[model samples]
Target: MPQIFFLSRPWDDRDVTWKFRRRPAPAEPDTLGGHVRVDSRTKNLTKRLSAGDVAVIDHEDIDRVSAEALVACQPAAVLNAAKSTSGRYPNMGPGILLDAGIPLIDDLGSQIMDLHEGDVVRVDESGAVHRGNDLIAEGEWQTDELNSAKMEEARSGISVQLSAFAHNTMSYLEREQDLILNSVGIPSVRTDFDDRQVLIVVRGYHYKDDLQSLRSYIRDYRPVLVGVDGGADAILELGMRPDVIVGDMDSVSDEALNSGAEVIVHAYRDGSAPGVKRVEELGVPYIVFPMTGTSEDAAMILADSKGAKLIVAVGTHSSLIEFLDKGREGMASTFLTRLKVGGRLIDAKGASQLYQSRISSWQLVALVLAGVLAMAAALTTTEVGQTALGLAQAWFLDIGNWFTNLFR
Candidate 1:
């Protein structure tokens, strides 16, 4: 048989090498005992993933957000048909899985996609996958040492990533300058953010803990709560109703759409709202905001234009790594959006560190009572107090005598 040839680039240098990963999956190892939940789309697959289930996906350079979603599902292992990290920009998804103690079998190729849903398969120590006595598919099982080495290597590409990031910012600014500088495509909302603190929640890193930390803030300020896509479900999870739900409406639940929250469909720049039909079918009245950015950016712009005094963001991206974690060039819009909404917005991801415990009503009442008793004690010890007490006692005794005489 003739050897196969394919061009591949090494992470360190800009050189191509003849390498092939599509060769009939390295003869599947002899093994048999695992169940896999398969989906080519990582996002969709995650929704169906449950504890102890091995997740099979085809995500290349899996980002941090996707990693977190997978970890949240508590999968037993992960099988990827593509490179978990292509050395593009030090993607952390694979590292996150390794940290979570999940076995990540990487670069198994497209043949792995053939495994039907709910099929019983077994993965061996050599990273080979088998079904009954038949060899199915196989790949490299990433270890902490290997993942770290790759991460260290990818760090060298940061300068390139930053340069590209800068270009993206200018590109977005050029296209959406009108939307950013002027209130161009923003729609009017009845939720009324005017003079009120607005809380925008996104389903992102540490969102649960961040939301819990805001219990006091939310109760005290009662800010208009805005949820972006899956974030509406997060709002509902807290037994709180969202004031407005925004996004393409794909990740958000039907219940959130019907929860009396004003629904707004985030449409593409061309005015195509994929979520519009779902809203119509649910009999929920909706407004479409045609924009060129992510739902997160749109929500902040809407709140700012609507006159929100302060915007406390929950589970939103504030760091460079997280902005890059979505693995989309559009994230450049987020950087610009942040600059536009400056001073008005604060990220609550760091809420744990910033959160101050509020004094309870019971404590305040006890303090007041103690103060009153201390004052009474001080009064009794003073000469002027004794005189006042004597007069008050005489007046009370006289009143009591008069009442007794009248009753008799």
Candidate 2:
């Protein structure tokens, strides 16, 4: 109604929720009103958010990929039951929402979660939320200035985060050194990775675009496809089937499990798998993988240990801030899992850059045009073509003469 967009679209954060950070842009409108759609899981909320619906979410330190989803759904505004940026790290999601001209009401507390879905909600300029005639909740109005200030404060905490990251890395290394360094205890997988390139898909950052950029590479190489939970859906959306699906299965769809991918459930270090029951109920056979780190880490280790010639990863976290945005202090360095697979591992953006085609589209088009023109020129040099050209010239000349005679 109010210029309903009057906007503007990535899917899924299975691993390393890092995106390129941008400065916060100013909010376009101070006031917003719409029916509420509430979800505690931000990823789930994004799936159902429609244009003009005010998003009611309970996500703390909202990551960029989730913000992109909310913006894509064109929500009238966003009301958070938790702080958008918890000042643990300078997360890029809130800044992204503001940049898209969506109003953000922050830190309303868990009480705001009580707002009924489909209820008519109003977010006033002062950041007070009201349902009908009664005020339901109030929160901090997130603006460009506040976002910028909070980002600065969050940046200061990075030193502390880094120290914690170092400690976590050491602890993880001590616990999982054999698995990381020796590939011990990796279960037998049906999908062979030996001497083949592997593309491991995750749901963070600019995943869709980054994956799209590798379309040519995917076609040329036909790498072994592995999806981490919701990432399988991403591959499916791109019109390709995943060869293997890996994760806890919490966020993955039933449709993906049914899509015929070899399902591998990420299990606890003690070997208890959580998502096997869901997979079993769907009639999908699965194997369990026990690891001490993130699923993405397990994915890389699997690929590398099985002799994947090269591994390209989409939507993985690579920086300090990105690891912190993962909401775990120990996320830094992917617990040095990269070191184990460093010989073969490449991030999506890096892969896209390094895997460029030998000839560009413009060069190809120009070459084609040149060949056509040369063929036409060669044709004119032939006797038959010359005769045809003369006929054309005579016909035009006769028409010109006829017009001149009529004028006289």
Candidate 3:
């Protein structure tokens, strides 16, 4: 009989340690009767498991990609590997699993990694309990029945958590925005306030590639560049400088401050978490805004507050996947902030749309006019003048035809 094992949220092994320090599951552990252990925060842990192997995962861990991958493995069962099945994040909670008809062993504690592959386990659905491969406990056992109960339990936990998060999120947004209004004394800034094209570039952990691309587009019409916290490092990597560095001031390097960009510190609603003190220690002049949101949101607020003509956002997280990936409580705040600046927000991936190298239609028209004048100048000598006039007329006709064709 195949055995069931509960596992923790698996992590991908390849993600650099700079992201999260990973401890490998022990090969010869005293716990779980020496079950294989793979521990990390990223989904890389999925590769270690073979098909039909049991996996214990947090309900919050189920995303479209990872969920499909696990389901493809055709695991006999998956244990709910979270401390609280409902409290974890990413996707709208673990509701996806309940919908998938997967069995969830809930209220499971450190027993999460106790079982190994090929061990027989029995789940009692009506009783809500698990009996190990040893099967010492007495209970009516049926796989389908237990699977249904597990799904129900998982669904209940998910629904409760999702509703709670939604309510809490809305409340947090209202409270934060109100605080921003009263304390910061600035309205949620609008993107349409400025006509000058400005591109805000962030150089944080994953932004090096995007920042380099932004560098190739730098031109005579220099746009205001804003870096969020450690994004300043990304800016320096691209051989460009940031005009403003905004964030809580924890991750930014010393060199970034002295590099000549102004600094703004994002703080909590009560003004207690002053990110500026550290900057002041470095002798960097900084302003503190006690608005409850990420520094990137604060950067946009500042840009709009100061009247940027057009704001092009680069390296900004705009999608649902990105918001979930950040794993923060302030997502609602950022969401509302964007709504306040909706029309002005252009994606960084579409940065090329703002400027083009080819001469514009207006410039082409001016070039044609200049050529006509030059032809008139050369027409002074009679023989040459007639030749020049004929050529000029032909050129003018061609130009006119091209314009007509262009509009059509």
Candidate 4:
């Protein structure tokens, strides 16, 4: 029988004087036992991951967002067939995993992909991987020192990446000139935006903070809410329903899809929409908007084309580093799209900071009641107010006596 080890707290307690003890060494290798879960796309992999799972992925230079998602699942270990950091751009994914005390095995090669899901696998102290008594693969353990060296090397190549990014941007601009020059290919949807404020939410850096800050604005203006991909879930999380959900459909959950919001599946310029399949399976009605740019760009353009008076963005990328962190190769469509939208576009942070909270009806009523009480108290305490009150009481008594005499 194979010995099973559960690493509920793999590095919690350490023996300080284990070397001082004289004992026979165990013959078996130190190992972890778990079911194998594999996916080439890190994003898709995270959705299926559970605790104690051995995540087998083929992500090269995994980005921060993907790493964060994986870490949230609390896996037993991460086995990667590709280099976690390819020295491309000081990617933060590998460093984040290692810092979280999760074991990262790198460069296990393509053969690991052959392993089926739920197959029992064990990784030994020597970084060798085994599948049911058969030695399948071996990889280098990612240590802090090795990760640091790769990050430094990646940092050195930032300039080259920037140049390539610029080239890609120019190419995209030339290809999608119509989007910048004029309003074209705006898809029709049920949600109306004519002469209304539109709030387009994207799941990006600091999105939650920005959204929270805009609570007053959202309550006041009641803007037409548009969620791009996972942003629909964000909107739902805040107890607001999205008027329209636009995305490729991979990241958005089924609950958001079934949220009774008008769904628009983003497609390539060639009219292939991958998200429609899931929507169809859910028995929900949806339409396709085939475009080349991102779902965010598509959403903004749609709002503008529908005669929106103002467009506010929450959690949208505004800086170059943000774009790089999202692993976007080019922002040409985004830049041009903003230019087309022009004066209508507003960042949520700026709007939230500028907006002043308005007093509610209950607060106004309380203020009025407090004012009346203060006036009554002042009248009772002041000499002049007391005299005036006594005279008013005398006048009332005299009127009552006159009425009684007339009746008699």
Candidate 5:
């Protein structure tokens, strides 16, 4: 008989111990077990998560994208040092985790961030965090009911969010007017894009799908591939090498940095480039592009200034909610960057959907068949074909006469 065990909730003020008995296994919930993996940056944290491990993160108001990444990791449980849903916006992260059957401990306190990586921790039904026999932190366990209530409340505040987003956009425009109107501080890159298509990929929403869809375009045109930070890893995932990798260098993996791609570290107008240190540590050759916009924006400007005939952007945030989710105070530079690249710029989705392969396997086969049939018909219409047919008929007649004579 299988042994049965019941893992009680930590948030419950009850002392529960695991008892093993030889009998038919009971339908009891299993306790979460594994080394606790902690990171303040949720994006970086997701890269390290493995199945059955508990994730301790300090992300507040976790957005849908971050939540999806966490869910993909299939963690045993998630303990947030900050609120999972701050009611600031209708963030779908917490709800997604709950729906995926992953326990989410909401706002255990900032001290939870101090939990070293690989520390063994347990979470109970009531969402109490425990280290060995001592309870270290406690938080509310997010459930369907609570998440729904918070989402409803957040929905009601959309008007306020819109107003704030508009204000921020205007503020961004004011600060990044130069990036929008003219190319300024665009760095020289070894990769030439003169009269060629340039593909700028960011590890944003649906980037993988967009990249997959553009496989044919990539193969045919062989566009200059530019990856923004973690996007470099995405390019590598598809078995393609990046021509240039640009970003702050935090979320990108070391493997991508050493992939022989020309590294361009994006820096502020004040000449501070944090990613430069990582690049130096790796001893990879790199250049610094000091500009007043996001890495994605800088990539577009660089491609445009380099005389790229067309620019295709993948996973670049465009919607109001996407910008809000990015937690940027202003999108002014992005707006201006778009304007600067105006006619040349195209969204990945638009390009993929619009692009039709000039020739498909079936089409090629049909064309070959058509050519064969057309040649046969043309040959049959000529005197040579008639003479050949006559000769074939005479040969068959001679064969028939010979067989008849032999039988007789």
Candidate 6:
């Protein structure tokens, strides 16, 4: 049987589609070549693949995870859904697979009629390839060096860019997050922070209700809002502004920087810097912490040092898959960082356990007003008024149905 894996989300767009789905039963056919679906954003999707797993990567998701996943899969071959190797859109998957001894099969998703597992097939890398023992020629051999070179060039561009981002930006943060978490000794700071506690927002992991659950707590506890790198953006999404934004400054958007948050630029040990310039250009106050780890780690450390009684973390990674996505060893750094956190380092996952229900009384008042307006419009004789009523009714009905379905 060909084992097939399906990627749940695209690589570049991790922010919107990072939610975990309940595992579903596999329906794909078993082939001699195993089919694996890897998320474009999954850091180690390709790196963790075993031999014989054919990785199906989205042609659009040209990032390190996709490249690494393709390498890790070590598949019999790769199938490009996009087909064309040239265009504005990126196709990093095909090139990586080809370089790693995997055959590049373009448009296999549309061309193949049917295929099964364990089928004896001869790949004609010398010319056009054939699937199974049938020796059927599905495509022509490429003679153009330029077209092939385009593939290599595309792959190289993506690899270099992602490697730089990961090494300089992401990896730095990961290391820093570890250092603070692992650093032993609970030293209290003399700084009088405005808040009683602090909220840390991480980009990935289970944070669906993290912000929502903490809404009341933010008001009651008066926690200093802190965002780690892109976690700053996540903080804004929750209708909260961060007091401090920590990271190497690659993934964060300009809107995040302009949100009146103080920036803390994570610098290298030897005094080399990138984020300092950006923060200065934005006229944001920033302090450089030259460390070997992630900004999240630094945030925790800063919070502890600054006299925070409790540190609440939201959307933080706490699983094997997540750690592997980082392409790191065990969470030794995270373990150590936690030791340095005195008082409480509460994981947001635990906070999600409790729930409080409340009625939106304002919604009822709005509905009644809307009904009166609709009734008033129904009595109008003008064509424009009738059209407006019809549109309003349709919109209300659609919204009502949507809400009703949610309950059902």
lDDT of 5: 0.79
Top candidate (TM-score): 2
lDDT of 6 by residue, 174-224 (tens): 645544545433223333553467888876443545677778888887778
For each candidate in turn, the TM-score is: 0.78, 0.82, 0.48, 0.73, 0.76, 0.46
> lDDT for each of the candidates?
0.81, 0.83, 0.55, 0.79, 0.79, 0.56
Q: Write the per-residue lDDT of candidate 5 for residues 1-408, one digit (tens) a residue.
A: 111122222211011111112222223334555689999888988888987788999988887678768877878788999999888877667766665667788989988887888999977766778899978788987776889899889878979988876676677677666655665567777898899999999987668878988888999999999999999999999999999998998878899999999999999878899999998999999999987768888888889988999999998877655666666654545766787789999887434444557888999999999999987887789999878878988999999999999999
Q: Is candidate 1 or candidate 5 better by lDDT?
A: 1
Alpha-carbon lDDT of model 3: 0.55
lDDT of 2 at 366: 100
Instruction: Give the per-residue lDDT digits (tens) of candidate 1, residues 1-408.
Output: 111122132222121111212222123223325578999888789999987777889999997668868877877678899999888777778866665556788999898889888888788877888877787777997876788888888887878888998899999999989999997989977788898999999988667778988988999989999999989988999889999999989889999999999999999999999999999999999999988879999999999988899999987876666666677888889998999999999888756646456998899999999999988887799998888889999999999999999999
Task: State how far residue 324 of model 2 sits from its true place (Å).
Answer: 1.2
Tens digits of per-residue lDDT, candidate 3, 272-375, equal: 75677798788977776677677878877777666677677776766544454355667656666677667887767434334547888999999999998887
Query: At residue 205, what lDDT does model 4 achieve?
Result: 48
Q: lDDT winner among the candidates?
A: 2
Error of 3 at 255 (Å): 0.8
lDDT for 82 in candidate 1 is 92
| Model 1, global lDDT | 0.81
